[model samples]
Target chain A: MQIEAISKANSPEIACVVLCCRIFIKTASAEELEQFVQAHEMDWDEVYKYAAFHRVRPILYKVLDNCKIPAPVLGRFRNYCRALSVFAFERQVESARIQQVLGQQGIVVRMYKGLDFTKLVYGGDIGMREFTDMDMMIDSRQLPELAKVMTAEGYECSQIEYLRRFPEHYVANKKDICFYKRSPMGKLFGFEFHHRPGNFLMDQSIGFRELLGQDYLHHSAPFSQEQYYRLMLLNHGASDYFPNLRSLVDMALLSQKGIGSVPEQLRRVERLSQELSMRLLDGPAAATPADNVVMRCATRITKLQLTVTLRSVWERRYMHIRFSASFSDTFRMAMKFLHYLMLPNELDINGVQLFSFKLYYLAKMVRCVNFPGRFKKVFSRV
Target chain B: MTQHDIVHRNEKQFMISNLGNEIVLMDIQQGHYINVNPVGSVIWNKLAVPIMVKDLIHSLVEEYGVSTAQCEDDTLKFLQKLQQHHMLNVQ
Candidate 1:
């Protein structure tokens, strides 16, 4: 019932959108479902668009059967659920295959966000969580083995030059080298092989690799349940300034179920997420009257075409990335930013051949030259 | 379509998943899905490559204990259903 007052049609706030999602993750009573639909049926399309943007419609679809979902909404929801189920299946198969191969070969690795994480967060249902990419954490020493095994499994190195071309960015990010395998339908999912944790901005040490290493790993070091929640919270709070509500819901769902006792650090992180943004219960309390318009404008990469403006950019940046800053963190980020600009290399172009050093260098040069213009635009907004 | 007409899968239209005892085929183009038994699963896999209907019948008769006439009838009906759903194209 309370969820009905959340996201309205045409313009939906981020807090309301997340609150609407909580109805499904936590499972609503029939009365609550009826009230929600009765209240928001007219403007449900806006909620649908919001859910689609966040890539969380499939999880919500499971609850449709218990409620008297409208025909049009049900059709759209079912179609999305089916499509997601197929992609999730593909991701699951590919991820499992990779893990199987690597494990057989005795390459100790940790699978981060993929089918396993979906199962951990949303139970063992195949399509409960949308999986666009599979993230794994392996030691830097295992890079050659990762490449070979991925190649054997028909995965092509998406960015082979980034490691050598921009050592500073590589060191700063301490992240994955994505490898891709295209499905029969031409859909591509990347196998992001992470080496370490922490970013230039966040000094948090809750990485799955570091958390469940050696004996606790069962020789594979798959992300333990609690560890995944911890990482999600850490990432949402610190490393990833623009934390998606879907991810927060994932943490909440796990926390609600009381799976894997929450550590003191994670409990602190959860409370921080509540304080930083609108929490699970806070509805539209923190949301502004124009937040929906601002959100619609901020979602530039999606179907919406909001005109870019200085204030809109500032608002979008403010909404998406709200980071806690210390002098040292800013100093380190500034250094990393400058170093990346000096020698840019993290470039992955669609249909472009990775082996072409000339083309790669050309793209890198273009980014480096235009970096100043982008940097100026950021400050211009504020 | 003639019985001798070549029959293979219009892979662009269909996505087949073998679920042990059941064969699930999704007509992605039409947004419809159908399931068949183990017998249909074998026939579907055999239809991966272009083959004459008679040849498919012969293979089915040899592998399955069903009579030639029954195999032909059932297979024809199954193929026709596939065609009706746009899961297959009969030339």
Candidate 2:
């Protein structure tokens, strides 16, 4: 893609980060990278900020290590890379231990995106990807037994605590629960147990059994190449709103592994994500569709800010509704948004007594009464 | 184990990564990390297969152009530390 095209709405610094990450994936050449870096007269601070925010710092460090950069700035990047490598190593060790324990209990849990992708896509060099937590797919029915095992292993599930107080809410809404434990070294480790492969917005929840097959209990490979790519598209693209450059890089790398064509059953948001990724990596000519409508939608989504902000949140929700697969899905997303605005979960009233729960509800209702005005502001910004 | 004995990595107890110049080893059972420097990383890589301590010292002396006495002393100290941490299988 043209450098100007890459920076259309994004700051030049963000474009640099994206190009650097692309270079690491071999979509762009080192000479082009050198020219881009030197031509921008870049702000090193903004480059670092966006790179870290997008969780592409490791890739950025790899590409820029050979480039002409200030000594101190390069040192900072190296330090982050080293720290992430150690952190990833620790998580791997923890993942192996948990998998072994769960295996002995006759409950198989297959790892997904985080460390699994590090090994699959990055050649087992965890430093190439920075992931904060581990994601594991498990049988939803086994949760009660899994909870027991997790507790025995010193993991605390706050979702279970929430479920105890409001079982109906949890059962109706949540497909995953996070278990956390602090290491002796004071580092916090998180493991998210997913019962469903994709989000609630998808047409149906593809269960672990359906996606990985019943025979997967004995098989080592968690997902086939095509299934893994589809999962990435749905979970990261459709579910997450394709929020980061790292996701794009992941799609790019996975596509090169001979995953064949994108599935025809993809949701609107997922299609848009795929088109945008292809366009960014291979330029506009590489876009498969001659359809102006799809190209327009992809371009619009690309122009949205990649960072988290109130405006971006509103934009993402708009995209979610606009790209929803069905009217019912749109309605569900709308209802969930209102629910989030009006309801106070356990964490919101953690220290409050039982009687104060009603007071808390009343206060929330009063605050939500003014939500229309806030909604108007968000809409106007869009 | 004496200096003449063979030593190898206790591979089952640790997960290792050679990051850039340093070798990082995570002790799976203890959740402790040991960062090995470039020289120590060379020794760790050499220990992938078993090697006697005396031979290890001799190889380092040849490669690094260090005196025999100094190489032997440093190599023995490093090996003893690994043994203390149960990261080495000495025979």
True contacts kept of each: 0.00, 0.30
Which digits, one per residue and each the tens of the lDDT, describe model 2 over residues A1-382?
5666666655678778878876777878878878877777778988898888778888887788778888787778788877887788878878889999998998878888897877777776767887898998877767766888998999987666555555455545567878999975589999998877654444454555554567654677556666677778877766676677787788778777866555455545445666877666652234344345456656664655333232355565566666655578779877766665566555534423344434656545544564667544533443
Supply the TM-score for candidate 2.
0.76
Task: Itemize residue pairs with steric clashes in candidate 2.
Answer: none
Error of 2 at A44 (Å): 1.6
lDDT of 2 by residue, B17-79 (tens): 655556677787877788888798899889989998888888999999999999888888998
Predicted candidate 1 versus true structure: per-residue lDDT over A226-284, tens digit per residue: 67666676565444433355665665665565455444534434544443233333322
Error (Å) of candidate 2 at residue A112 is 1.8
Give the range where candidate 1 chain A is weakest over 10 consecutive residues by summed lDDT: A301-310
Q: In model 1, where do residues sit more than 4 Å from their true spots?
A: A1-19, A104-106, A164-173, A204-206, A213-223, A259-268, A276-278, A281-322, A325-328, A340-343, A348-366, A370-382, B1-91
Candidate with top TM-score is 2
Q: Which candidate is the best by DockQ?
A: 2
Query: Model 2 residue A265 lDDT?
Result: 56
Among these predictions, the greatest lDDT belongs to: 2
